[model samples]
Target: MTESTTPGTASGIREFRMPDVGEGLTEAEILKWYVQPGDTVADGQVVCEVETAKAAVELPIPFDGTVHELRFPEGTTVDVGTVIITVATGAGGAPAESAAVREAAGSAGAVAAGDQAAPSAPAASDEEIEPEGRQPVLVGYGVSASSTKRRPRKPQAAPSVPGQPGAAEGGPRRPEAAAIQAEFNGHAAVVEGPTGVAGAAPAAVRPGGRPAGSAAPSVPGGRPLAKPPVRKLAKDLGIDLATVTPTGPDGIITREDVHAAASAVSVVPAPEAAALAEPVPAAAGPAREIRIPIKGVRKATAQAMVASAFTAPHVTEFITVDVTRTMKLVQELKQDPDMAGLRINPLLLVAKALLLAIRRNPEVNAAWDEANQEIVRKEYVNLGIAAATPRGLIVPNIKDAQAKTLPELASALGELVSTAREGKTSPAAMQGGTVTITNVGVFGVDTGTPILNPGESAILAFGAVKLQPWVHKGKVKPRQVTTLALSFDHRLVDGELGSKVLADIAAVLEQPKRLMTWS
Candidate 1:
């Protein structure tokens, strides 16, 4: 709050500046303030959290001092460098001798000691320090250049123990008892999972006065009831099932009820059907050539691929996998209530398989740089999905993809695809990609020796899904299968290393359960 110094010189007051709130947000609207006049703040304390267009970010105080004044009021739009709060620092308390303050204050830049007032000095001298690398100290106002920091939480008053109903305890409530009660009463049932959905199944009920187990009359002022899934579909689409006439067997609602309900709500796009509905629109320009801007992800990818291609003596490896078990798992997952509403494409399985394979052969994920004279091996997976958008090719990765569960990975893949399609992907999202998977299969291509995204040692190409004749259980039969192509920088990766990585991926696809086994 106060510090001692020369008669005219005083301790400098520091101001905390607001940070770039959003990823690319240049300005923010100050939503509200937690501190006001006369509030004591510690360093790295969050005084206010501001909301940007995308998300809310908390701004922290840079210095520990008493709040002097809030320059801008709440709801005011502020630029980055604008100082939001001020703290008065000096030796003596508020009212002090003006002579001592002048003696304490040196130039206007450094606050004078003794008096609470920073010495009144020439403003011209303050401008000289800007180029010298010494940041200007506030005359009790302005924010610093650093982002806000979080403060430690203070202890709260203790609560009474559950069993010891009357007596107060000096500690937190007995966690064990509450945990036991939670387990027994299935309180955890209501707890939402990482997917943000509650886990408990809804209670079952029968129509009319009779329970589901009872032998109820078929036509006692009754109508056939739709299944839970069907009912849910109808509710989601705002469809009134009572108004619709059922033409199902025995006049019972069928799967058609849900399909009809969904279609009535919104028509889903069928890419293949749309293609057949009209001839493909040729570009107004020449069909032989399409130019794309070399910027952002595409530019970065081109640079990396070219560097990897020329720098790392490249070697490619391929493997044809039956993936019969993987296909079977996809079918099983479609029926799974947990995996419902997810895109159960082969690429999802391939991503899981690649993650499993990475765990087994972590060396394949390494990068080689002769110029830097270094080989970088990363422990975490920033799994990049090579997406071909209308603009150009972009590989935006899901950060920490290896740490996510299969369902989480599927969800992330869906988001990445959606984000890329919407052209809302951030430039930061496309950087620092460790390993990549190109789903060439989407374009109906069998396989291609895909280029390795620069910085990564290897890339896995997932080919088109197809049913082909193959040997299964030592017998010839038709089975769902696909080919996996792996391209690697031979400079850093070798034939043995590439083979192990490819084989591990194929093994997981051969018996999707191998994922659990390897991981």
Candidate 2:
């Protein structure tokens, strides 16, 4: 296990390295493996599913071959550029040496489990294969040579017992002999002494009256059982897991347990102590205390939000407008023959209006590049629609959204929503976004100052559309109205530019015919 060996043959072996499934993600966990040894696989066939920090992605093999070996087991987190599986292209079964190599690879993976400090083996030079006439490459991924090396195992020492001095270090004793001595002599077992009287061996009784020296029982480690996020919470609160009493299933330390421990040590004011002692009935439930591991989509979203909030100077502007005409247009589109079987909703027109606004005020559709100290203006728009899924919030955008017609945009939006709801959104679809629109209207919220998505300059929040009293043409009447809030990075977009973009969107929604003239 000390040496990194390639798990393939010399002639016709291909090692499929773990690709970076997200934007510069360094590692991913192998959730499941679809193919095993001796299975025939074709090009573009999905071989495995991996969960990165963003989303769960399925990796497709690029070439046709028989599965030779899977280097790492499922649930093992593998670094990008490391080989996870190998395929054999030869006509026959794998060579005898390849089988031995597969066994060695499995042993190495087991020895390195749960130990991130373990060194990995270097990529095998002989196992690297180049297809004839073309260099192989994965889209949005680059090939790099890397490996994991294993640390040598250390020998286990005998457990030293208290109050015993040089008792049983002589040699190994037979269990049967010890049992016979206990039965016939009606006394505890004793080991032979060194030129002296027989001495009783230090025998610690285990459960069920078995001697500890007969069979060593496995003892759990001192580290408490808790998820990564729970451990992080405990660290942040300066709470020690070993000191807290665990009430969770399997003796696992939960977030609530950590919080309770923190509250116990905190100094409370005399006035609030009586109020805090009263238990709130609303918090009572079997599932009220839930601990979710902050990983995958949720973890990435949190990190991005923090970076965007602190790094950019955010300016939020709100405007309330009458959108009665836009709702009429939605109903008209749903009745149109060409728009049949397509999703037609208020959000669709809102998105189109935002795109048109960007066209009018192109300066707002830009990102501030701090590294280059320049404003990067985008000519075409990659309109990002923020969708909340069961896993977390993900913003998947349509590529070249400015060029799409209304019907095309509607179709793309429908597909995007469906894919996100199913939790099958690819990482590429979530990248290269220039602007975003978050529809808080669906949740019946009036409006909100939404934080900008990372790498984007502006974000528009579409609020709930409600019929309210308004003055129209100097007459008081009930009209369909909605509130819109636009948040932008002040560094690249000033107050004037941001206001123009917001005003343009409000005008188009108020007067539906303006979309034709404005475009």
Candidate 3:
């Protein structure tokens, strides 16, 4: 039968291309599929959930129709404009159910290649003929490209008039089996009927799952029972729709219900339970071949680092300084009544020092645009703080950070870190950063020349602060000393400019009052 005769064929099939669902995010990992083959969908309806570099986003279908096919399985990383799904648009928007006939229309070489790769199955003995329809699912998955071709259906044989011997088990079971198999290959097989007649039951029910009693009632509500986001919420919250009461107007499960369930279960901390119950080190190698798919933030960082390392002419300068006053300020801030409930740390002071340094050298707070053939000097700073998240290195920045006070910057930094660790930072928070500061001190590292984040002018590395011998008042004294490494795009800032910026940062850390004088 022509696809036009299929309900799914009612609407002509249109392939939906993956869009930049996240803000300027070019690609995404298919986290889950909300609709499957044979499911009806509406325009603007979310059909799939994709995880962008920063957050997970639901991809909405642009056309209304039955889903004809899924181009790729879940967890596949698809670039923008890649066709991920095809929706049927011809037969009243209903998709035609596909038949299950195995046709070898491909070249013999192609079929042989596929068969060779097929998982090994028990070989049939020479005395016994292999079962006709016993091919495993793996074999079907490896079918040749031409195996998708469908042939015209042969005419159905005349129905048995009365108690006629069937073609099965010395009875008429062949005809019935033929009818059912014909649905897939358009060719009939013989099978015994209920009364050992040639044709009693018109269709053979596949064993397993409940016997097909009647067709599922068409949902009168018209709305989809669940949407992409709702389905995701259900899965994350572990709420089974089979039990959750539908409060939606048309008996559909609304986002509210999904959210309510999610909120209810969210407090239970399933991950925490699993982590505590069985403390297995994920870093250790295990059996069954553990594979960490390259995607999300880790993938984006890799791509960006590659681009930046090759494109930017980088120049790094390092200096060691006594940040004793900065450490003392942190202690005072922690005990200050005005700064109560605020997180105080050396990073905050380092951030303040960096801000002052940026003010000293705006050249460091700019971008080199080879395309425009111009140096783009950012008037406002989207200050990125490099955070090492579980996903990977993510630098979520604060917009117009040059405008924020030390206290405000501290709070923003805290929120940024928390949001990044939770994988909730939006793409907006990760883009448009003019400069960045990576706190390698948290890991007790001394210092290293960090690579510039792609498209930015510079990145500063903050080394671990510790008591070290330093000349104070011409006397060697133990002081809180740390190293600051400034890596800048040489094309934009020469050594003189880069060194001056790094010096200004070290000077401020050496004597905190210098910030007040500079500001």
Instruction: Give the per-residue lDDT of model 3 (tens digit) for 256-364.
Output: 6654544433222445642222222323333333234467877888888999999999899999999898899889989888777776899888888888899888877
Tens digit per residue, CA lDDT, model 1, 407-509: 8988999999998786556656776888899988888998999887767878899998789999998999999889899988887788998899899889889
Stretches > 4 Å off in candidate 2: 1-14, 63-76, 88-289
**Best candidate, lDDT-wise?**
2
Clashes of 1: 29
Write down the TM-score of every candidate.
Answer: 0.45, 0.65, 0.58
User: TM-score rank, highest first?
Assistant: 2, 3, 1
Give the per-residue lDDT of model 2 (tens digit) for 422-482: 8789998999999999999999999999999988999999999999999999999999999
lDDT of 2: 0.70
Ten-residue stretch with the least lDDT total in model 2: 150-159
lDDT per prediction?
Answer: 0.59, 0.70, 0.65
For all candidates, what are the clash counts? 29, 7, 36
Candidate 3: misplaced stretches above 4 Å? 1-17, 23-26, 32-49, 53-55, 58-73, 79-292
